[model samples]
Target: MFAMLVDFASPVSLDWLTLSVIPILFYYFVYTIYSLYFSPLANYPGPFFAKISSWPNFYHSTTGYRHIWIWQCHQKYGDAFRFKPDGVLFNSPSAYRTIYNSRANVKKGKFYEIWPRNTQNINTLTTIDKSAHGRKRRVLNSAFSEKAIRSAAGFVSEHVDRWNEVFLADNDGKEWTSPKNMSKMADYLVFDIMGDLCFGKSFELKEPGENEFRHMPHTIAEYMQFMYPASMITQSPMMKFWVWLKPRGLDSLFESMLPKNIRSYYEFVEANVARRQKEEEVLKRSDAEEGRGRNDLFHYLFNATDELGNPGYNTDELYAEANLLIIAGSDTTATTLVGFWFYITRNLRVYEKLVKEIRTAFDRAEDIQVGTTLSSCNYLQACIDEVLRAAPAGVADLVREVLPGGLEIEGGRLPEGTQLGVAQWSIMHHEESFGDPWTFRPERWIADSSTGVTPEDVARARSAFNPFTIGAGNCVGQKFAMEELLITVARTLWRMDARLVPGDNLGAGSSKLGWGSRDKNHIVLRDAWISIKDGPMVQFRKRVD
Candidate 1:
């Protein structure tokens, strides 16, 4: 039977197997050739290994200090450096205006294409089409308008009670409460608070003064690390080809490699979206009655329609935007305050100054509500802005690619399709940009002659600091996020006495750019998330009062 089968198949064909090998070799040959000659990136200079190959750049990004390395490259080369075969590392301030500021030609890269939800409509960040982004932004614009935000502050204001509870939770009397980490507790409070306001979904992350959830921060840390590689690999046209030919973005195969702590995260926003859709029909019917109130972010978003009068957020759009809100509203602000809190916590002097200012401003924690917390706290706003500039949730120098016509930036010629942008971290730290760039001088934020800072200094200092970004291409949610950060930080300071213990440090995720605020990798020193930020750590016998 074997002989008969072999005969019928005309024996083993080395030809077929050999043909497959040829294509495999040919693909690499083409890759190598283009990587050398025809590739438009051929002339650009980069690390010798990266210019010759893609492995070095991809692997470096995966190793966790990708920001440091990119900063190194920008320092070594001039403003624009070819990071890999396709992606370029830029460190020029003017590059920002060229790429992100100019709206006519550039839109977000398709590298963000994989980010769109398979089950939902495209989100603000994922829309590669300019028209779609414009349309979505227009509809979403009114919700974040000054009037709308002032209205929404009502929801943000309510979370302070929950926050206060966390502060006083386990205080039996002690010093610095055994080294608690503020990041997690702050995150739980922020995430749940934002989730409730945005989707009416209560994650209940905060209880008294502690976080019920541990997985959220770990999940987020993992997700950021996972996405960080894209800045190197996916942004590069060459390496992206290699990855695509194989498997794809984070699937089960990759998820299996992560620690179980990271693996256990629940998609709270996703679950909430599915849960909320049922209520919309009820809301629409109740809309007929005069006193049947239906007003919250969820209601407004759910009821909002497109230009054609179609209801806001078809099921797909609903989930995507809600998921985005969970990410946007919580993560950015939490990250900002975590860094801010870390800085003030370590610098007892700054913390004291902030405390005095906050204490005098609010009669009580309850009175220091969101709107009032932000409005009355001028120094608080300045400190928050300084923190943001020092350690922004995202370093600006946001990239924009010059399309067919090319962009002429800072009066210099940039070829068509040059991907470039300024480095916010570098600029913010430049000795020329900030005096004694390494020191955390919150005094620079205040009007003071003690630091030798003058009115002329303030006027000239504008160029050195561009944290929320400037101009038309700046962050869309800047106003809302700013209000939230200031209120959250000031209110926390007003209620709790945050102080850093000696020998304590921010973990690996922080950038150690000289004099810049510390960025931590976010490991907890002690307690639950909500408890850590509650502060003073039992040092006081009576109370801060």
Candidate 2:
């Protein structure tokens, strides 16, 4: 009787186990069917798993391979392809204009909100509201205007000279010395420049002793490493429970989950903002009494007024903008500088040509200033352009959402509420737009009658190049950033001779996509929101000539 009872119970347990898994299996079956045939994006071509879920793209993003994967997808699936269930990636230049420029109905997508800021208040970078972004941009434009950049040029030049001095002293009069990583040095120099511009103070990052903000760039990189995955999880229904539990004093739990570096970065910005506010009040009183005020970014923000005389950013907004400025103003310029050095060193011909142009243009390093003769060095400009094209700072998609009426793209009309963006890395490197796209050929940008590059080549390159992005919501600091690059690159190359240390992995490896995609031919970039670059271990010596 006991044995018969045990046999019956085993079958009952088996039935329970089978029933438990049925709902999960059914859900996956439904998801696969909808993703493959029944969904709105069913007609779009993409990896089957990508069509079914956002995880594949998210995983690539987390692994620092998002741009490479997108480029591969573009190669496999044509210009327009689905990268996520609700997202479409474009590789055509026209598609870039249509989505980002024609801002009639579309707006920045929900993906941007994943950037951690004040939950109640969004900054210019993360704001999805078009009108709000426009308003913020208008006020901020005063700080990034031509007059402001020109005013800041003296400050920028001073820092650039100081950086050269630091490098020289570090070498201790050696003919050539390998500083190991130019990337970290570039970060220090740019961070100091940003500190001066944003807070009216220099972090003195290039100086000897420990500086509090010296680790900021690394901290920001570390913080961004987890942000992509965290953002994905934050957007899901699971976050709803956290919100619901907030009233029960669970807010600290969420805050506790934030990385220590991110919190410190916020505190650093907050302190600076508070200090600047105090200084602004004093400056206002001083202006009333002595008729003088500073011209730094904080001063501009504090005094900025819209067309209607509306006050500029509030305290929290100031904090957000200041934080964004630190990252954008520093990291992008630093990344480009690092990539520029890597390419110029790897390609000796390009480096020699650039050095000749810069050296011929400026008799002395002091003469290389923004908006001066340095801008006329066409080859130098071409090298800068090539660097931006080859290794754009922002490697990932800059997504925008389709609005109520839907939107037209290169391939077809995207349905309403669909997210669309150009995969910059893919588009800039597209074979259809550029011949031998992977090659570091700055001559392609130069319209020399002798070089044999046709006007068509120049036109195609112009149409495809958008390192600072395009449209109404493009980078406000574009002019300033270009000026910084022009001055820094020209000055550094003029003062120092640079070459790669023998055995560094930075542009050295087997080719991947093409000859240009070789590990050794191009700077290997790791994307963590912004492209993080490592060693080309360049050795530098003071040029006697």
Candidate 3:
């Protein structure tokens, strides 16, 4: 029987290879025709190549030019355009609201789930399950509340003070000292603050001596470099096989690919969470008899309970949240500071005006507290607003999937399973949204008639402004971020006079997309999921009143 089967197989020949190729070609032909002219999204204007394949979008994303590419497409295709066969990019403010509406049934797309925590448990940010996200959000809200932020304010100040000392010591009493890149300095400062808040201790990154976590920022950058391609890879048809083999094959592949420091970072968070849990256990035992305890972000998170007195988060969830807090809290605030310094230093007029505002607003640098006097510095706030507008930290798309019954957008109805979002870089720089959109003018946010900023201009800018985004899933640490920015900026400007290094165009507009430079500065930032800013070297000197 075996010999007979072999004899029969010999008669088939090599013609079957041609048979297999024909169906694949046919399928491609059918898909191209459908996606280009017969699909539900066929009417949407976009590059013909983009409408047929995901490769164009994926290629731009991997090269950190996704934001720039989308912005350019909007320039060609107008406010609404198809960015991928399965996705649409919107440039209008109303479109942003519609896509991210709290009442909408939309859910975060597959992209959010691509990056997994070491524990393999979904955290608030990565969770696509709406009900689970709601539960997590409820518990996490306590950690970022008004009282919680106020409690954490001292940590912010303490770290800032330490950073100042570190900066000055590095200067060695020179009248003018160039530390090169302000971006790394800001990262170290913010990392220390976030370390103290999230881990119940400081990483001491701003200390004079060697620190174990000094490479954290670089490690994070490396980790983010993996995210863009990984996200796109997970969206492919082969992802099913990848997921199936993830437990053994792909898991090891991912683990081996991670930078040593990235692995160490996760290990550090796990250890820190374990240490804090032990401390909380001791504190609970002592609290029953005595009253000795401390209040910080972890304290709030640990004690958070729902209406029924159930704990807000389990052990894995606690680990996940702690990991997220460090990354989100530190990276964003640090990036914003980097952009803020780049702009203000380059634009001497804005710098001098901000300096005057900071010096006049407080008699001493100590008076620059978070909510008290810092909030009153309108010019400082305007500078922050302008920085966020021109060079936002989260420059890429905050993607969401359209739900059943389909969703109504500005242009038309999008079918269910469609992924869409407003590319933040495009919306903020939309010509209709602001006058001289490419220019870094804080006056657009100031509403001053004499400065040529009309109330209408301010209103229009405000409508389009979504630095931290909006709605239910908006940044939980929004207030915390604002407080940190105001205090850090006001205190730094008050104590130091910063001048832009010669021949640096870090803050200048280098791209047709608007703010960041392609040369030295890259102030608008080169997007890699998280924006990567190079340098805006500034010489700093102690202010003499």
- Considering every candidate listed, which one attains the maximal lDDT? 3
Could you tell which candidate, 1 or 2, scores higher by TM-score? 2
TM-score-better candidate, 1 vs 3: 3
Residue-wise C-alpha lDDT for candidate 1, range 143-197, written one tens digit per residue: 5666556666656667755665555666653434445555666677778777776
Cα lDDT tens digits, model 3, 1-545, are 87765553553644666678899999989999998988889989999898988888878877776788888899899988987788888999899989887887588888876666443656889887888888889899987888889888888887887677666775664577755578888888988888889877888777767877899988888778767777876555436354455665666788888777877887888898999988887888766543255567888898898768899988888888888888888878988998888878767888889899899989888877876577778888998999888888888888898889999888598999888899888888888888677777988888776898888888998989998888778899988998899888888778887788887764445645542334333355667778777667777778866
**Candidate 2: misplaced stretches above 4 Å?**
1-20, 172-174, 233-252, 258-260, 288-291, 507-517
- Model 2 steric clash total: 5
Q: What is the lDDT of residue 114 in candidate 3?
A: 68
How displaced is residue 432 in candidate 2, in Å?
A: 1.4
Model 1 bad stretches (over 4 Å): 1-45, 52-54, 102-104, 119-121, 172-176, 208-213, 239-267, 288-294, 370-376, 395-399, 459-461, 470-474, 508-545
Model 1, position 219: C-alpha lDDT score: 68
Q: Give the TM-score comparing model 2 with the true structure, all chains together.
A: 0.92
Reference-based lDDT, each prediction: 0.59, 0.79, 0.81
- The candidate 3 region of ten consecutive residues with least summed lDDT is 513-522
Q: Write the per-residue lDDT of candidate 2 for residues 1-545, one digit (tens) a residue.
A: 87865664587878987898899899989977887897777888999788877778778777776788888888889888888777788888788788778464688766676674436446788887878888898888987877788877888899998988777786664577745477888898998888888888787888878777677889888878767666544333325353345445554565778677667767777888899889888878766543255577777788888888877888888888888888888878998888888788888998888898888888899988876587788888889899898888888788787889888677577788787788778887888778878899999997778999988889988998888887777898989888888888888889988888876665444555343345567676776768877766788889856
